[model samples]
Target: EPEVTQTPSHQVTQMGQEVILRCVPISNHLYFYWYRQILGQKVEFLVSFYNNEISEKSEIFDDQFSVERPDGSNFTLKIRSTKLEDSAMYFCASSGAGNYGYTFGSGTRLTVV
Candidate 1:
C-alpha cells in the first residue's frame, strides 16, 4: 500500500527560527493537506491544497505559515518564524477525489525552545 512519508521525524529549533517540514504523499492522491497537534491539544487543520492551489485554510494558517508542493510528489509546510507556541506534531495528509481514502503521514515533531 502507498504511504505518506515525513522527514527528520523530529526537530528542535530556537524560537523565531525558520523551519520547513516535508512530506511525500501517495502519488495518486489529488488532495493535499497540512494539520498540527499541539501537546494536549486537538488536531487542527491548517490548509488544504488541490489542483495546485489552496482550496481551504484555517485561521491558524496565518501569513507566517506557508505550504508548497515544490515537486509534484512532495508537499512542504514552512514556518517563517517558529515560536515556542509552535511546538507540536505537524501532519501531512492526502486524499483521492470526493474526499475519500485519506491517508496521513507519520508527522514531524517540531520543538521550539
Candidate 2:
C-alpha cells in the first residue's frame, strides 16, 4: 500500500522562527491535506489541496500558514513564524479520487520554545 511520508520526524525551533514541514504523499492520490494535533487534543484540519490549488482551509490555517505542491511528488507546509502554541504533531495525508479515507504520515513533531 502507498503511504504519505514526512521528513524531520522531529523539529525544535524558537518562537517567531520560520519552519517548513515536508511531505511526500501517495503518487496516485488526488487530494492532499494537512492536519495537526496539539498534544492530547483532537486532530484538526489545517488545509486541503486538489488539482494544484487550495480547495479548502480551516480558520486555524491563517496567514501564518502556507501549503505548496512544489513538485510532482512533494507537498510542503510552511509556518511564517513559530509560536509556543503552534507546537504539535503535524500530519500529512492523501486520498484517492472519490475516497475520504486518507493515508496519513507518521507526522513531524514541532516543538516551539
Candidate 3:
C-alpha cells in the first residue's frame, strides 16, 4: 500500500535555529497538508498545497513557516526559526481527492530547546 514517508523521525534543535522537515507523500495523491500536534493539543492544520501552490493556510502558519514541493515526489516544511513553543509532532498528509482519503506519515517529532 502507498503511504506518506517522513525523515529524521526525531529532531532536536536549539531556539532560533532553522529546520526543514521532509516528506514523500503518496505519488497518486493530489493534495498535501502540513499539520502539527503540540504535545497534548489536538492536530492543527498549518497549510495545504496542490498543483505546487498553497491553497490554504492557518493563522499559525505565519511568515516563519513555508511549504514546498521541490520535486515531483518530495514535499517539505521549513521553519525559519525554531522556538520552544514550536516543539511538536509534525505530520505530513496527502489525499487523492481533495479532503478525502488522507494518508499520513508516521510524523517527525521536533523538539525545540
All candidates' lDDT scores?
A: 0.93, 0.96, 0.95
Clashes of each: 0, 0, 0
What stretches of model 1 exceed 4 Å from their correct place?
none
* Best by the TM-score measure: 2
**Residues 1-113 of candidate 1: C-alpha lDDT, one tens digit per residue:** 89999997999999999999999999988999999999899999999999998999999899999989998889999999988989999999999879476799999999999
Relative to the unseen true structure, what is the Cα RMSD of model 2? 0.7
Model 3 RMSD in Å is 0.9
Model 2 over residues 1-113: C-alpha lDDT tens digits? 77789998999999999999999999999899999999999999999999999999999999999999999999999999999999999999999988478999999999999
For candidate 3, lDDT tens digit of each residue in 16-45?
Answer: 999999999999899999999998899999
Model 2 TM-score relative to the real fold: 0.98
What TM-score goes with each of the models?
A: 0.96, 0.98, 0.97
Better of 1 and 2 by lDDT: 2
| Worst window of 10 by summed lDDT in candidate 1 | 93-102
Ranking by TM-score: 2, 3, 1
Query: Worst 10-residue stretch by lDDT in candidate 2?
Result: 93-102
Clashing pairs in 2: none
